[model samples]
Target chain A: MSLESDIPSWVQALAGGGLIGLSAALLMGLEGRILGISGFVRSVLEADPKLKGPSTAFLLGLVLVGILAQFYFVDTLTNTQPRSYMITILAGLLVGYGTAMGNGCTSGHGVCGLSRFSYRSLIATLSFMAAGMLTVTLHRVLMGGM
Target chain B: MKQQITHFIIGILFGIGLLLSGMTQPGKVIGFLDIFGNWVPDLAFVMIGAILINSIAHKFLMRRGRPLFGTGFNLPSKKDLDRPLIQGSILFGIGWGLAGFCPGPAIVSIGGLQTPAILFGIGLVIGASVFIVKKNQVK
Candidate 1:
C-alpha cells in the first residue's frame, strides 16, 4: 500500500529498515546480545559495572546524534501536538510499566524477537498492536478526536 | 574498549533508522496506531524490511559458537504465554498510542534534552525501577 505522504518515503523507509536490521544483527554478532532499547535503558539505570559502561555509551551516542540531527537532519525528529504535560507524563509512565512487564518493547520483540522466529514475540507484537489500536479508539472518543 | 565503541556506533545507527523511518516522529506513530482512522501503513514497510534482513542475519549469527565480546548469545529462551506478557503488552500499547514515544525514539530524543521527552525518560526510569523491584524478570 505504501501511500505517499509528506513524511513517508518508501526509499528512505526501506533503507532505514535495512539499517535497523543490520544494526541489531551487528550488535548481536558482536556483543552477543539482542539490541533491545528497553533493555539498554534498564541497563543504563541499573546494570552492574560491566554492563553499565556500554549502556551509557549507547545512550551517549543516541543523544549526540539527536542534537546534530536537529541542526542538519531537521525533519527526522519532529514532535507532534504537544499533548498536556499530565497526559504526556501518564503516557510515559504507562509505557515504562508496560515495557517492563512485557519484557520488551518495539525493538526487542518487534525486531529482534520476530526475526528469531519467537512465537512469544509474534503474540506479544499482535497483542501490543491490538492494544495500541484500541487505545487510539479510546483516546479519540475520550479526547474529543484529539 | 572495542565493545564500547561498537555500542556507540550501533546506537547512532539505530537513532538514524528511527528518524529516517519516521518512528521518531510522534505524529507518524500515532497515525500508524489509529487503525480506524486514516491509518498510515508506512511503518509496516519498515518492520517487514527489518525482519527480512534480520531473519537472514539471525541464521548466520546463531550458527556461531559465541559472540565477539561475550561467552554466549543472550537471546531470550522463554516460550511461555503468561499473564504478565499479555497485560504488560496492553499497558504498553495504551502508552504508545497516548504519546507515540517508545523507549527507542524517546531515548534518542534525549539529545535535545527537551522537556517532554526528558520527563518521559524520567518516567521510564521510574517504571523500570518499580518493575525490577516487583517482577525481577525483564526481557
Candidate 2:
C-alpha cells in the first residue's frame, strides 16, 4: 500500500516547513540568537566559550527530539528508500560544506532570510532553486530520463 | 515575559507540524526533486501552504509597533552579494542536488534515526567547524 494513502505528502511537507519556521522564531525570541544550523553546528564543535552553553543545550535538544519522535512515530513515516549509501554520504558532505561556506543553510537563508526580506537571502534562495533545476537537468541527461 | 514562552510554544508546535508532514523523508524529497523522472508536483502545494500561513502571520506581526521579544524586527542587515554569498550558494545547490536534503529537512530527518541522517549530521558538524576555524584564522 502506498504511504501516501495515510496522509497526503503535501500536508506533511507544509507541516515540516511550518515547524522549522516556528522553532526558529521561538529560539530567536527567547535567546536573542538566530536559529541558524550552521552557527549551531559550529558552536557545538568549536566550543566557543561565549556560545558554548546554549549551543550545546540546543544541539542536544535537537537530537533528543528526533530520537523521541522516531520512537513514538516510526510507523507513521515510511521507511527510507534503499539507495547508494555512498552517494547519499557524499551529498550530505557537500551540503554541510556548502552551508558552512554560504554562512547558512536553507533554513537560515531560504526560510528565515526570505521572511526577513534580506536581499542576500533572496540570492541564496535563487541559487538553491537554480541548482535544483540544474541537478535535474544533469540527472536526466545521465540516466536517460530515470 | 510571555513573549519568550510564546516563541518556545511556537517551536514545539512547529516540531509537531514537521512530524505530521512527510517532508522529513529523503525518498519523498528526492522524488519531488526528480523532475525529469517521476516528478511529483505536490510539493508545490506544501510551499504554497507555508507561504499562505506565513503571509497571514506577517500581516499580523507587522501591525505591532515592535516585536514582543525584541526591540524591533530581527531581519538580516546584509544586502550586498559577495564572494562568500556566491560560493556558498553554488555549494548549497550542489549538496542539495546530490543529497536531496537541505538544512531544514536534514534537521527534521534526525528524528528518523536513519544512517544517512547520522552521517549527514557528522559531516555538518565537521564542515561547520572547519568554516569557523578558517574564518577566525583570517581575522
Candidate 3:
C-alpha cells in the first residue's frame, strides 16, 4: 500500500518527525547521553567489561522494540524494493565508518548536536546534507533519475 | 544534572516528531528515495517544517546565552575543512541514499524490529568498531 492508501501523508509525516524529536529529548533528559546511534552502539560494544552484560541487554532492548512494532503494526509498515543483502550491508558499513570518523551520526550531530549549537556538529551536519544532495544528483545522472 | 534533564526532554520531543512525521516508517523513507520509480515530494515538506521550527528555536535559544539545562552552550570547535571531513561526508551520503535510513531514523525505527533495520544496525555496529580501533591505533 502506498502512503496515500489510508491516512493522509502529511499527518503521518508530521507525527513521525514529532516523535523523533520527542524521543531524543526524553533520552537526553533521562540519560544525559545524546541519542547518537553510532555512540550508542559503540558504547554497547566496547563498554567496560563489567558493564558488558547490561550494555548488551540495552542494545537488545533497542532491537526488540523494532521487532515488536513490526509484529503489532504489520500493515502500516512498508518495505522498500528488494535490493541484494550485500548492497545493504555495504551501505551500512560505510555509514558506520562515516559516523565514527565524523564523530557523530545524523541524529547525534544533525539533530542533537545542532540543537545544542555545537560548532563541530554544525560543520558535520552541513557536510552530511551537502553530500546527500550531491549523491542524489549524481545518482540521478548515473541511474537515470531514480 | 540540568544538562541531563534537558537532553531527556529534547530526546522525547525528537521521538514524537519522528513518530508524527511517519519518519519511523521505512516505507515513507524508501518512498522518498525511490524518486526514480514513484516520486513523492512530500518528504520535502517534512524537511521544511523541521527547518522552520528549528531555525526559530535556535534563534530563541541563542538569545538566551545558556540553554535551560546547561551552564553554557556546547558547540563544536573544529573549523577547518579537511580530508577526514570530506571523506566522512561522502560515506554518509552514500549510506543514506542507499538505505533510506540515516542514523536518527534508524534508531527510531529500532522501536519496530524490521529486518532491514536490524541489518542496518548490525552493519552500524561493525562499522563503528572498525573506526574506533583505527582511531586508537593512530593515537
Candidate 4:
C-alpha cells in the first residue's frame, strides 16, 4: 500500500476528476440525468421494475469497475487500516441514512449540484465538510491519533 | 435498452475515475478531512477538476434543449435550504469521517469484495431501508 507514484498526486486528482466530470456530462447530455451515487442507490432500492433499468445498470457498472480494479489497478485501490466491524457498520448506517435524508452526497451535492450553481448543494457541501472535519478532529482527540 | 447501455458505460467511466483519483481509498479521504492534522488537499483538486468540466457541460447541455436519449434534463428543482438537507448532511459527514467511505466508494468496494466494505454495505442498506420505510410512513 504505497502512496508513492511517479506522477504528482495533484495531477492524478485532476485527471480523475476530469473523468468523473465526463461521466456526469455524458449522463446529463445523453440521458438527461444527474449522476448522484446516493440517489442512484435509493432508486435501486425503490425500483419500480418498469423504470429500474437505468439505475440498476449504472450500479452494476460501478461494481464492474471495482472488480476490474482488483485484477489490474490493485496498487491504486489499497484499503486503509481495518476498523472494527461495529464501527464500520455504524458508519455505513450513518452514511446510508444521512445521504437519504439529505437527498445527496459528495457526488450529488459537491460535484453535480455545485456544478449547476445550486445554493442547496453549496450549503449541503459546506455543512458536510464542516461536520466531517469536526468529527475527525474529535476522533483524533478521543482516540489518541489517526 | 440503449439508455441502459449508455448508463452502464458512464458508470464504468465514473468508477475508473474514482479509482484513478484515489477517491476510493479511505486513507486519502480521511487525509483530506483531517484538516487540522496532516491534511491532504488532493481531494479538493478532484472537486475543482470535476466542477470545471461539469459546469461547462451543464451550460452547453442545458442549451441543447433535450438530451440525446431522454426527453428532458432531470435536474433537481429544490431551492430552499431545508432542515432535512442540513441535518442529513451533518449526519452523513459524521459517518463519512468515521469510516471514510461514502456511497460511491463503498459501492465500488463492495464490488471488489473487501471485508470492511462488505460490512459497511450491509449497514448502508439497512440504514437506507430505514429512511425509505420512514419516508413512506410519513407520506
Q: Against the unseen true structure, what C-alpha lDDT does each candidate score?
A: 0.82, 0.62, 0.60, 0.89
lDDT of 3 by residue, B42-110 (tens): 565565455445545555656756644445644446766667766786687677766666765576465
Residue A143 error for model 2, in Å? 4.5
RMSD of each: 3.4, 3.6, 4.8, 1.6
Worst 10 residues of 4 chain B by lDDT: B105-114
Ranking by DockQ: 4, 1, 2, 3
Clashing pairs in 1: none
Candidate 1 C-alpha lDDT tens digits along A36-90 = 8877777766776788888888878788877877677756777764667887888
lDDT by residue for model 1 over B17-130, one digit each (tens)?
A: 877787777777888888888787888888987898999999998887788878899878789899888888888888888888888888877686666777777777888788
DockQ of each: 0.67, 0.44, 0.34, 0.81
Model 3 ranges off by over 4 Å? A1-7, A22-35, A46-65, A113-123, A130-146, B1-16, B33-38, B53-74, B108-111
Compute the interface RMSD for each candidate structure: 1.9, 3.3, 4.4, 1.2
What lDDT is obtained when candidate 3 is compared to the true structure?
0.60
How would you encode candidate 4's per-residue C-alpha lDDT over B1-139 as one tens digit per residue? 9988998999999998898889888888888999998899999999988999999999999889999988999888889899999999999999999888988878888888878889989988888889999999999
Q: Rank the candidates by lDDT, best first.
A: 4, 1, 2, 3
In candidate 1, residue A82 scores what lDDT? 61
Q: Model 1 off-target regions past 4 Å? A: A1-8, B136-139
- lDDT by residue (A12-49, candidate 3, tens digit) is 66555445444554444343345566665666566755
Error of 1 at B35 (Å): 1.1
For model 4, residues A1-146, the per-residue Cα lDDT tens digits are 34347989999999999999999999999989999999888988887574478888988999999888777777656766566899989999999999999999999999999999999999999999999899878887788875
Whose DockQ is greatest here? 4
Q: Is the docking of candidate 3 incorrect, acceptable, medium or high quality?
A: acceptable
